[model samples]
Target: MEETISLQDLFKTLKKRLALILTCMILGVTIAGVVSYLLMTPTYQSSTQILVNQTQQEQDQFTSQEIQTNLQLINTYNVIIKSPAILDLVIERLTLDMTPGQLTQHITVASEQDSQVVNVTVKDPDPHRAADIANTTAEVFEEEIPKLMNVDNVNILSPAIVGDNPQPVDPNPPLNMAIGAVIGLMIGVGIAFLLEYLDTSIKGERDVEEILDLPILGLISPIPESDVNLDNVVRTRRKRR
Candidate 1:
């Protein structure tokens, strides 16, 4: 026969295994906290902004075809900024120990839609190194773009500055711990229900009756000492006769 469990039964099951669930949750969260603190590496990020304009004048060049041409080339410039040709020079200028590809991996170039501004970001383990990389990459790109593209269109709008106290970007402890706790709780609940489902031992008289499908004739209580002695004497007399 198919058996269906109700909400009450489910609650009862969880209540019965609440201790196990709580233990698992605590252990899982503790492990997660410790691992997050010990095994995770911290990363720092620095960013600089560059403006892509044909001339240094502050006037709006909205109607100029040259401005539109520069806008179209912004995408190409964004790609070139992360290429080996540019990053290689930046690496040599800075005397960095990393390869061109490695430097490229740490750099990001982004530009807004219909805007002439470009944002460059660099991430590293050291805050100062991150800032230096951002600044140098922008500088090299500014110096090299004129010769390569025949247009001095890139301008360093802002350079990356390190504050008195820089913040780490990766290994966010609170967020990691929260996610770990949630995952642990889910696993704990799943394990609790799984154990309950696998348990098939009879726990009560109702279970026995249901399994046997027989009438329970009677249930007797223990006899008193006097009644037991009287029954023994009667049995002895019957044996002698």
Candidate 2:
């Protein structure tokens, strides 16, 4: 026969192992906070925007096809922005020690759907360096695209600038601690249930019935030592009488 657990049993188990669960949660949160604040390196991000638009010859309004063409070209620009053709020049201009591949890892190119503006973002340990890389990448791409595509449509819309006190984008301690707390809670509950399942020793009348599969005819409570001694003295006095 399969045995089923009820809500009472579950609550009892939780109460029995409450201290262990709390200890695990506190430990997990502390570890996460320590790692986020001290051990992990923080990363800062900076971004620059570039616009893609075709030059008109007769000062006429742009047609729908011309605007759509520019939007399509933005995708190609996104790829070129991260390629060695642009990154190599960016590294040389900025005097960065990293290679094109390493620089590529730091760069992200994205544009809104049906929008002509491209956003180039770079992340680094230093906020100023991140801004410099973002701006230099945009400048290099602006200078090199005309030569590569035989068109002068790319324009720097907004350059990246670092503030007096820029904050790092990564290593959020509170979020990490929250996640750690959740994981620790799960682990603690799992351990509690596991220990309950592994325990087979009997503790009370209910356990005795469950183990022996028999009903108790009567309960015999053991007498304390003081009560037994008093009973023996009373029996001796009766015998002397």
Candidate 3:
């Protein structure tokens, strides 16, 4: 037989498992908060920007063609910035204790659409090291592009600097807790429904009628012990009289 649940049944299930759902939510948020604030390592970010443009000797005035070419070159520049040729020099200059591949993973190169400026961002556990990596990568790219591409078009637009108080960018506790809470809620509701489906014991007259498919014919109420004792005393008095 197919069983159908109505809205009232759903409400009843939720009410019955309300404590379980709340506990799961609390556990989820607590775990997320702990992991974000204590277990995970916080990463700090720093970025430097470089501009790609023709030198004064190469071009006296900027043309539409020159601007378009520089914009297209930004894509190639982004890849070259993260390549080992650039990262190797950056690692050597900054004395970073990591391979070119490892260093490459931490660096991100991007530019706005149709813009000649490229941003090189780096993330690290140490704020000073992150700033150093960003600046060193930009400087190395600027110095080496002339040799690699045969053009001195790259120029440092802004160097990354460590502020008086740097903040870590990763391990956002509030965001993590919010995500954890959502996941917890989903799991809790699922478990609540599952438990409701598994429970089959009859608890009331409606459950008995549903299981047996028959109408109740009669009702037999149990006599209370006090009422039975009073009846027995009245019978004894009548017998004595």
Candidate 4:
């Protein structure tokens, strides 16, 4: 025979283990908050934009093919921007103590689909350093692309600048805490169910019937000690009085 539980049993289990569940949840949230707010390092981001255009700006009107050509070129330009050819110069200009690969890890190159604009973003512990890396990468890429690709199409659209208060781009506390709380709740519920399953000792008449697989004839009541010992009962009553 298969065993099954109903809504009443589920609610009863939760109620029985409510203390353990609450403790686990509170502990999980507390640990997550502490790690998110104090232990993890905050990373700030800065972005610089570069515009890709053809050299023949004298043409008052650019055709659809001309715009599409520039957009296609932007893809090649994106790869080159993060390449060693550009990153080497950026690292040298900034005097950063890292290899091209390491520098590339902190930088992100993005451009909208079918658009002539590229955005270069850098992440660092120092906001000013992030901005400097972004600006210098854009500058170095601007100078190097014309020589490497033999075309002068890339132009600096906007340079990065640090604001008075730049917020970090990572380690969101509320989100982390919420996730931790959910995991803790699942663990707690699992433990409660495991304990309930493991408990096989008979608890009442219903349990006895379930275990023995027999109908309960009746319940046997125990005789009170006072009824068997009248003198002791009288003495106990007098003492209570």
Candidate 5:
């Protein structure tokens, strides 16, 4: 016999396994929260801004061509800021124990469209060191760009700083917990449906009829205790006679 389930059966399956589903969700959230907050190392980020402007601007007059040229140069400056030529100097100055390529992994360079400003963001486990790396990279680039391109165009605009208390930017606890909850819910629902699908036991009259593909002729009721005792007594009297 071919067996198929209805919507009512599906709902019943989920409801019957509701406790297991809730347990999975709660367990997922708890584990994610613990890993994010206590087990994983957090990274702090700091950013510094550098301006690429023409050093020899005429007195009180800035030309549109000069502004456009600076805007175009911002992209080149963004690339150079993360290059080994710049990062090597930053490493030497800070005495950081990492190669230029490894240092590049901790730094990001970005520039706004049609703007002459570039932002260098650095992330590290230590907040103060992150700020120091951002500021030093900007300073080293400011000093080196003139020699590299034979133009004094780079200038530090805003330096990164660490306050008395700094916060980590990575391994966000709430976001991790939310993701875990969604994944756990999906797993729980899937498991509930899977268990239901794999079940093959007959549970009631409807299930028996569906499995056997036959109609029930009649129902048998259990005999009462008093009636059974009276029948036994009659049997005993007949036997004695």
Candidate 6:
């Protein structure tokens, strides 16, 4: 026969092993807090914007063909902005230690649907460095694109500026700790039930009857030593009488 557990039994099991569950949850939260606060590195983000148009007059010359051409070329421009040709100049101007590919990996170029603005974002461990990278990448692209594409379409819309209190974009300690605590609680509950299932020692009359397949005749009450001594004295008095 299959064993079925009810809500009352489940609650009893959890109640019996509440200490283990609580301990696991507390340990998990402590470890998560320490790791999030002390071990994880924070990352800061900064972004700059660049405007893309065929020419100052191209806005008046809006057509399906012109839009398609511009969209197709935008991907090429995105690639070129992160290329060695542009990033090398940016490195030279900023005197950065990183290689072109390393700098490129930190940068991201994005454009909106049917919009002429391209947003360039950079992430780094330092806020100021992130801002500098963003601004420098934009400026370098602005200067290089006009010469390479032979069109003065790229213009700096907004330069990346240092934020007053820039926040880290990564290593959300509170969120991480909360998630760890939840996982730990689940693990603790699982372990508690597993131990309860593995326990074979009988603690109740029902367990004893079920395991041994015998009816309990009677239960013996334990007598205290003081009571036994008083009974012995009473018996000796009766004998002397």
Best by TM-score: 2
Clashes of 4: 0
Q: What value does the lDDT take at residue 166 in candidate 4?
A: 92
Query: How do the predictions measure up, each by TM-score?
Result: 0.79, 0.86, 0.85, 0.85, 0.82, 0.80
lDDT of 3 by residue, 1-241 (tens): 3467899989999999999998888889999999999999999999999988755457667799877777677888899999999999988887878999999889889996767789999999999999999999999998999899888888999999999988999989999999999888888989999998888999777777778988888767889999999999999999999
Instruction: Give the runs in model 6 whose Cα sits over 4 Å from its true position.
Output: 56-66, 205-241
Q: After superposition on all CA atoms, how large is the RMSD of candidate 1? A: 6.0
Residue 221's lDDT within candidate 4 is 85
Candidate 6 lDDT over residue span 1-241, tens digit each: 2456789989999999999999999888899999988998889989999888666454556778877878888878888888999999989988999899899889998887778788899989999989998998888888888789887788888999877888998888888889888988999999999998999998877777777778999887889999999999999999999
For every candidate in turn, the CA RMSD to the true structure comes to 6.0, 3.3, 3.7, 4.0, 4.5, 3.8
Of candidates 6 and 5, the better by lDDT = 5
The lDDT of each candidate is 0.85, 0.90, 0.89, 0.89, 0.89, 0.87
Stretches of candidate 4 off by over 4 Å are 55-68, 220-241
Off by over 4 Å in 3: 55-68, 215-241
Off by over 4 Å in 1: 54-71, 205-241
> What tens-digit string does per-residue lDDT give for candidate 4 at 1-241?
3467889989998999999988888888999999999999999999999988766755888789977777668878889989999899888888999999999999999996767789999999899999999999999888888689899878899999999889998888999999989988988888888998998887788777767778999998877887879978788999999
Pick out the ten consecutive residues of candidate 2 with the lowest summed lDDT.
53-62
Better of 2 and 6 by TM-score: 2
Ordering by TM-score: 2, 3, 4, 5, 6, 1
Clashing pairs in 6: none
Task: For candidate 1, give the lDDT of residue 120.
Answer: 94
